[model samples]
Target: MSDPSMTTTGTMTSTRSLSYIALFAAVIAVFGLIPKIDLPFGVPITLQSLGIMLVGCLLGPKRAFYTIGLFLVAVALGLPLLSGGRGGIGVFVAPSAGFLLGWWVGAVVCGLCMRQFMRRMPDAKGKSLLIAAFLSSVIGGILAMYLFGILGLMLAAHLTLVQASLAVLAFIPGDLVKCVICAVLVQSVVRGMPAWRLDRD
Candidate 1:
């Protein structure tokens, strides 16, 4: 004896979740529209990483992962949705591929961190949430992404591990700045929507 109203509510919730996932995928693509800085070695720098941070911080682990996956699917379909308007199967073999793929993992990691932190501090205020978001961004958005990025540079550019690692140093400051910006935005969201659920359940 299933309740029709409950079934309808479940269907609505599922639809809403799908909408959020697609919207965030679009958000990432929009971030890619920003101009990228081309570098002689390694890959170019872009603001797309910030989008990953934001999605993770907002959407929880599972949904954030799905959002990033959706974005990748679009890229694989030959959409000009990457920084510098590059796309197609060729981009998969490019030096930035690992970093691009790493974003999916990064989003999951960041969302997991956010969920854990928020759960531990159920009464966490905006400032506390900011700290949590910043730490998570560093761990997932920067560290995890860089690990894959370095490997990508080595494989695609034929750079030694040391050389690839060194080349990435130039982008650290910018990434840190992005972390701060993401944290601030996330903090604002928490303050504005205290009833927001990490899982959106």
Candidate 2:
């Protein structure tokens, strides 16, 4: 027979996990509320990526992936939860769709990188945290996203690979800035509230 105490503990953990997922989903929605800057390449720039990065860094890989999946599902269900108040099935066919889909992989990659670094340096502190954060964001938030973003541009815009690649370059500078911001913010959270740290496992 299963121990009642163990069952209760498991239930509590599940509840906590769901709460975190919901909270981050709300955060992503809030980020989408920020006005986006439409570019000539047909994709708009928004702060939602910042929210995604934070989820990856804070929640770890599995939780971050599930959280992002929930957010995407909400958007798919016709919720106005995307940048520029856009949502619904139609958004999935838009030029920015690749980036939107890429966010899922990006979060997973970011979380994996963070977990790897954290494991290597279990006592990661101060500057170490910053380095881990930066590296994780660059790999997950930029590289992974661009791979899909470029492909999305090519398919949606009917552009050549070269053209799509060039168009994506415009976003690099801003994304680098975002990476730095994510690193700093994550370090601050870690230092200010130790208890809030999610399990790396």
Position 146, candidate 1: lDDT:
90
**Against the true structure, candidate 1 has what lDDT?**
0.86
Whose lDDT is greatest here? 2
**Per-residue accuracy of model 2 over 3-33 as CA lDDT, tens digit each:** 9999999999889989999999999999999
Expressed as tens digits, the lDDT of each residue in 108-199 for candidate 1 is: 88899888888888777768878989988998899988999999999999999999999888898778888999999888877788877753
Worst 10 residues of 1 by lDDT: 36-45
Q: How far is candidate 1 from the true structure (C-alpha RMSD, Å)?
A: 3.0
lDDT of each: 0.86, 0.89
For residue 182, what is the lDDT in candidate 2? 93
TM per prediction: 0.91, 0.92
